[model samples]
Target: MTAILTFFTTLACIVTLLPFSRHPHWAIRGMDFPRLQFAIFIAVLLIANFVFLNKQSQFTWVVISITALCLAWQLWWILPYTRLWPHEVKETKESSPDKQISIMTANVLTPNRKVDKLIQLVQIHKPDVLVTLESDQWWEDQLKVVEVDMPHSIKCPLDNLYGMHVFSRLPLSNQEIAYLVEKEVPSIHTTLTLDSGDKVRMHFMHPAPPSPTENPQSAERDAELIIVAKSVAKSNQPIIVTGDLNDVAWSATTRLFRKISGLLDPRVGRGMLNTFHADFPFLRWPLDHLFHSQHFTLNSIKRLPPIGSDHFALLTKLTLSPTVGADQTGLESNTSDHNWAKEITENQSISVNDVPQVDNSK
Candidate 1:
């Protein structure tokens, strides 16, 4: 029994460590196979330790230690989702009134027929901006009523699941549909002019998922994310990037993006607002995120009611401000730049002019 326990414990350690390495090869086809394999191995070991092994035995200490290590590793990945990290709200000196910008981002599952539920959610929130992923021509038409209220909008309707649509009460500047990965898979990039005349760049992405039926590899997705991150890092305007990233908040790629972009996640130190698998909340991870530059302060963050989609909508309100200086207090450190962004940017053929501009008002 001790031998059996030791073997399983060793296997669990191997499974957990396989996904820790920062290699894109491990992130294939909309599935982090290594992470999944590790999770399963850990579960098996945990069950064996509790159910099969004697608690008072010396072997049990070995099992507990192994289990604790695995749990610690898992917790490390989940740190960003907890939003516990202290964040600095740069002092404005004059007590500037909060400039709230409410946004609602939803991956309205393309095949989902519950349009009413989505519409209802929007009406209730009355968000300043609405971003929908997996939206096609039909979904666009269903949301037409909102246009009268929103006035400014960007629509990229495609039969492919990559279709994305953005509607905003704020004026749009340099709005374009960018093909970041495959030619057909597009992401929306635009500058939002707020009521205060402040401009903030927003990137709404729904890249091709890494799945057997989809891209079958995560290279394109990872590359696209890295490209956007690098671009935002160099931008002077506040950046608000949102979408169904198809990667978890705790994943290696996601952390790398945050570091490269110099963006702040609202979930850090706060609970993980797992948006996917709405039907099975416990099994879900945060795939939908609202990441912004340090120039903005989070007003609120929430998970909206499900609208017959695999993902639950994420709503976030941010108040924008200018960065005081590099020595600004309250800014959390310890973020690591893995040099992934520089490598991907070197090979990307991204030209802001190459993106297509569409006037949905027409």
Candidate 2:
């Protein structure tokens, strides 16, 4: 019993401390996720060590103290997502329908041939804009059922699982497909003309995540996000960027992205809204995300039901407000942030064509 508890205690301490370093490998950055799980495990270990281990030994006290401290550290990053912290984005008070925009972003797991559940959510939510990732030609064809309502569309269907398709009810223009980091991986950029005659620029991105099968390092993902952040920071009007960031909200990369982009996360003060690994509650995390400029206020944001994909649908309704920006101040970037962004850009760790292609079939 002592051996088991000691092994887990050492593991938890190492995992908790790994994310503090600047390493951008998947193995290190991946530790940024599951702070909640770490907290839970640490809490369990703290209790188990007390009950099962000898109290006379100095090792028991040392383990308990370190485990307790780790629990507090994990909570420090997680409490903001809960109800404890004040909302970074203000909830909409103005009841202006014309000035509102509702969007739904979903990852249609390539091999998951279930469209009915997703289609049903579309009907129920009736989002003005729908973005689908990991969608192939077949998934594109299946999604056309809603095209009659969402007339403006951009499609880039690929078997590589990085494919993305965007359909919007509002008029769209200035469309451009940019391969920011990886040549094969593409990001969709366009301007949506809303009913209020307001032009909002939208950048939809789904950079390949760092994993055993995907890109092994976080350099490509960081570079792509940093590029988009610089672009978003320059915009005077409202900008909406959404997709699977493949990184946790609290990660160093994501925090840097927010600082450079000057975008507000609706989930910051609301909830984590875990959307990935829909089948496994224990493994679920917030892989899918939406970030927007200060001019927008959250009208509604919720996690829709699982739609035959590994990710649950993310629906967000936001209103264009002039006064809300004062309440929800955009995260400002410091000199350190600018230097970090420049470093990621200059590294050029991953070539444009460095990523090898993968099979589409599951």
Candidate 3:
């Protein structure tokens, strides 16, 4: 019995560590499963160790050593949060016509029937822009009535679960659906013209989750995000990317996305706003995120109530600022400011050649 327990425990631990190791396809699907597996293994090991110690087992030393090693590894996973989070330098260029923009990102969980709850939340908050992920034809139909109030919208209703819909009080320019990872999965990308006539590019995405039923790997998802990050970095306009990323805030991939895109997360100094697993809050982690370029300042950020979905909605308010001089330009903006804007010159040319082409065929 002890041999069987030890073997399974060791196997779980090894699998847990495999994602962190340099694997050919590390970021394809959901990483939470491996993380949960590791947690379960540790819990089981702890219980076994306690039982063995109480009985004064002969192999207590071996058990203790293994437990200690696992604990150390767990600690390693937590150390990154303690380090200084990256911040963008403030820009001097003042916004032409400063305006406050409120955005809400929600994953409505396709099968969920709480349409009224979602509607109530939307009416209460009255955000300038609202993005919903995992939306389908049914979800879209339910939300159609609200479009009258929003005036402008981009709807891509699909049964594939990757369908997304965006509603905004502001005007949308150059709006298009982009297929970054898979053909069936599409991300909404557009420039939102605020009341002040200032334009900011907004990219809303919800990639396929990594799991056995899905792509079973996370490499493609990670690569897709990297492509988006690179595009955001090259943009001369202020950029806001928000969605249920299907990844944790503190994960290695999220950090890399921030660095490569030169965008700032508002949650730094603030607590982890876990938005997933709304039914069981304790098991949740922050999956929905709002990342903005250095040219915008955070006015406010908060997690909204459960709207009969597996995930909570994230609401954020921001202001826009222009870049200073050429020398001061490109310096990252602070994560805390209410009005932030990065300067992206219209003349700057970026070839789409570097981005990975999605294979529409499975």
Candidate 4:
């Protein structure tokens, strides 16, 4: 019994601390996703050690202390995502209809054939901007039925499953499709003219995940996020960065992205709106994310029902209240933050120009 407990205790501790390493390897970087799961494992082991292990032994106490610290460390990163923490993005008290915009983003899992179900949600939600990831040409053709209403849009459909599409009812200008990292992986950048004539810069990305089969290292994924963050730092307009980020809300990379971009997350005080792996409730994380500048306040952020995809759709509504900044403090990037972002991009074939600019012009 002690042998079994010790084995798992040691294993859990490794995963708990692995994420602190600066290595870009998948095994270490991927540890950032399951912090919640690791916390649970450590909690159970601690409970067992307290009840079964002989307290008189110095070794037993050491084991208990280590597990306790591991559990606390894991919770520290995740507790902020729960409702217990203060809201990072302020909620709108009274949102004006003309100043509000609803966005819906989903990773439709290219092979998913349930086109009608997804389209039904689109009709029901009627979002101002709709972004779809992992969509193929077939999905794009099926989705064309709604293009009449969303006349302003961009589509990049590919067979490789990195395909992306964005349909907007609001007027879109300076629309661009750029490959930020890998040549084949594409992202969309554009300016949306709201009903109030307010122009907002929008970026939709689905960066490659760090895994054995996909990206062997996290450098590419982190580089794409850092580059975009750098660009957003220079923007004067209201900004919206949304997509399947392939990273958890609590991960270091996500935090760095938020700091450098000076954008806020709606999920900071809300519960983890875990979207990925919709088929498995046991394994899920908030991979699909939407970050915005202080020019906007959250009206609502929710997870929509599954539509034959491995990820659940996300719907976020925000009001363009420029006054929110007076009350809300953003995550400002310090000198160290800027230096880290620069260091990460130094090796990559990335520059300020690599990040597409979406100015308010046709």
TM-score for all models, in order of appearance? 0.84, 0.93, 0.74, 0.97
Task: List residue ranges in candidate 3 displaced over 4 A.
Answer: 1-16, 24-98, 321-362
Sorted by TM-score, highest first, which candidate order results? 4, 2, 1, 3
Show pairs that collide, candidate 4.
none
lDDT against true structure, model 1? 0.73
Which of the numbered candidates is closest to the native, going by highest TM-score? 4
Off by over 4 Å in 1: 1-11, 26-60, 83-98, 323-338, 345-362
Error of 4 at 230 (Å): 0.3
lDDT of model number 3: 0.69
Least lDDT summed over 10 consecutive residues: which range in candidate 2? 353-362
When sorted by lDDT, best at the front, the candidate numbers are: 4, 2, 1, 3
Q: What value does the lDDT take at residue 91 in candidate 3?
A: 26
Q: What's the alpha carbon RMSD for model 3?
A: 8.4
lDDT by residue (17-64, candidate 1, tens digit) is 767564455333223323434555676677777877788888687787
Most lDDT-accurate candidate: 4
Better of 1 and 4 by lDDT: 4
List all candidate RMSDs to the true structure. Answer: 4.7, 5.5, 8.4, 1.4
